[model samples]
Target: MDPLSPVYITGCGAFLPGQPIDNEIMEDHIGRVGGAPSVFGRRALRWNGIARRHYALTPEGRWLHSNASMSAEAVLRALEAAGLGRADLDCLAAATTQGDLLVPGHASAVHGELGGGALELASFQSVCASALMAAKYAWMAVRTGEANCAAACAGEFSSRWFRPEFYEGGALIDTKGRLAMAADFLRFTLSDGAGAVVMESRPRPKGLSLRVQWIDMVSLAGRFDPCMWAGASEQGRAERDGGWSRRGPLAAHAEGAIALQQDFNLLKAVIRAWIGVYLDKVDAGRIDPRAVDHLLCHYSARSLREEIVGLLEATHAMIPEERWFTTLTETGNVGSASIWIMLEALVRSGRVQPGQRILCIVPESGRAMVGFMMLEAVEAVR
Candidate 1:
């Protein structure tokens, strides 16, 4: 078997539309609910600790469609961070569960908006797990020598289609709000946003290499399938004349409840399997699970995070004190972008150090868990 060596994440960037809304205003919009805040509208992220979120400005300064606007900005930011340019791009992979539209993938539209990159490109969507999946795909491309550098962008536009029926099937203009009205809760809290990560294979610079090695995908599909479906609403019915449909919120929430359970079970299995393989097959080098210093995990729900962090106290899978970095208080759940966002935060905070092993575990459908265990690289001595 081939040794999946570590791939370096050379750059990272994120973008939120301007005119950020604070938690107070966000609470007000998620709905006061008869003088009391609705329990779940914005409950998922209130104390997530994000200061503000950005959205786009229309001609009249309104928020634009979440995916396209945020995606374009994020890609540019990552490229700049890598000290590279569009000219250096070898591949572009756009990932999003909430896209600009159902028929035409957001990537095609975003590619056009970016003045049409000359590099090869594609789109990836695995619901909330897109970030890790996208990253895995990008890293694989480089690992296989298929590309020199790859960029993956994930935008969480969950709010736009809070009502799966309307978002997936069709949408009707809301006479009251002048926007789609299926989920009133979404309008207030779901800020349009995007995040991007640049992956490349770089030399070790006379020291330990910053690398991503061994991404294994494990899927636990049945638990979350009932909650997963294409959104099909009345407006969508009207738009398609009964063309498509989406998963309802109740089902979504049910799946949400179970999603983390499935994620945890599957992640443990994969890690054990990886270690077992190292001992039985690749016996020369064994990775000490304890050597893992950072774990970037997929953000499922606020409660799920609380439970896992509490339970994993011994291994330091993560800590409750780090909830702010895990749950995305202000950002809410940007689906596939969640883990990448956390990883990005660590990089920006300067917490990740050379030789420190970081494990980024992301969960996808069919019980697919992508694990990227990397050894940090020594930065160039300036």
Candidate 2:
């Protein structure tokens, strides 16, 4: 693929409802919501790097924004930033695991919220890496001449999926002594947010735009079951006696250790493959890891990020610590929206200058897929 073939990002936007809520607020609400009150939520917050997060619902438990509504807001802002309108959009690609319904899809939900249109629509259920996957698909569409311009968006409403009962249900007798339930551990880390980007086939001559240099995605579904899952286990179902459990919890089974078991080797293989694809560039003295100005990564957790970073550095990729960035502490883990949200924040922060390079990686717990994208900033007008 040509580096300057256009299929670049022209605009980006994000929607985070309400103000930042600390662990204190979250604990207070958790205490009143369901089952028994436990300190797991607060403990999870302390264990993770998250100090605060944005929630779509009020602390007192009022519904504020649904997935569709938040996504619509983000899409509108992105279109406006691109100097385009809804009618100008040729395609709308959405990626999300949590939507209003399981049938019509989140893409359809967002499309309907945008007022039914004839644009090409697609919905992806790629878990945490969904938005990045959507972006990759949109880039492919533009590169293949299927669409002149497309919007890739993702909306995540994690608040609704959390089950307070699950948090207080399980008790750990292990040495760690932490909550044995996934809900207890994940409640404080997951958050609600939406983010989007507008990509065009034609690159702007003078402005901040991300050119699609290269993208690679690989899924390891067959190799591992999802560490995080939403449905109930067979053991749980049978224990409950053929009926449904209202507070069906989303489980994060083994946490980071399971992912680390294979990622170290997988990442090495990915690096080798990347070198092979760009070997010509490297031979011609056009490739340099030190030239990478930014490392935008998915917000899984602080420890996981550190382990990955260590691996990257050990592999002779000299990624500067200051240049590496994420939104784990400020926004929690917005799942699929994490990638786009981090990108939007970086763009708005004005840290990325013209001609700089950015390398982003999306790591999902479910299916254990890793997506890689390398892009170059063209120009900065603002």
Best by lDDT: 2
CA lDDT, every model vs. true structure: 0.55, 0.70
- Cα TM-score per model: 0.69, 0.80
Give lDDT: candidate 2, residue 220. Answer: 61
Off by more than 4 A, model 1:
1-6, 27-61, 162-191, 203-209, 222-224, 228-288, 313-327, 364-375
Clashes of each: 31, 0
The predictions' CA RMSDs to the true structure, in order, are 7.8, 6.3
- Predicted candidate 2 versus true structure: per-residue lDDT over 1-382, tens digit per residue: 5543468888888999888877667656533334335545555565577877788876556779889989988998888877788888888899986687868888888988888568888899867777778888898888888898899999888776453333333332134444344445666677888999999977654568998887767676665444454544423322333222333322323221111111233434443443343333435554466787898878466756665655556555556789887877888888888888888899889898888898877777655666777888886444
lDDT, residue 32, model 2: 38
Determine the C-alpha RMSD for candidate 1 after optimal superposition of all C-alphas: 7.8
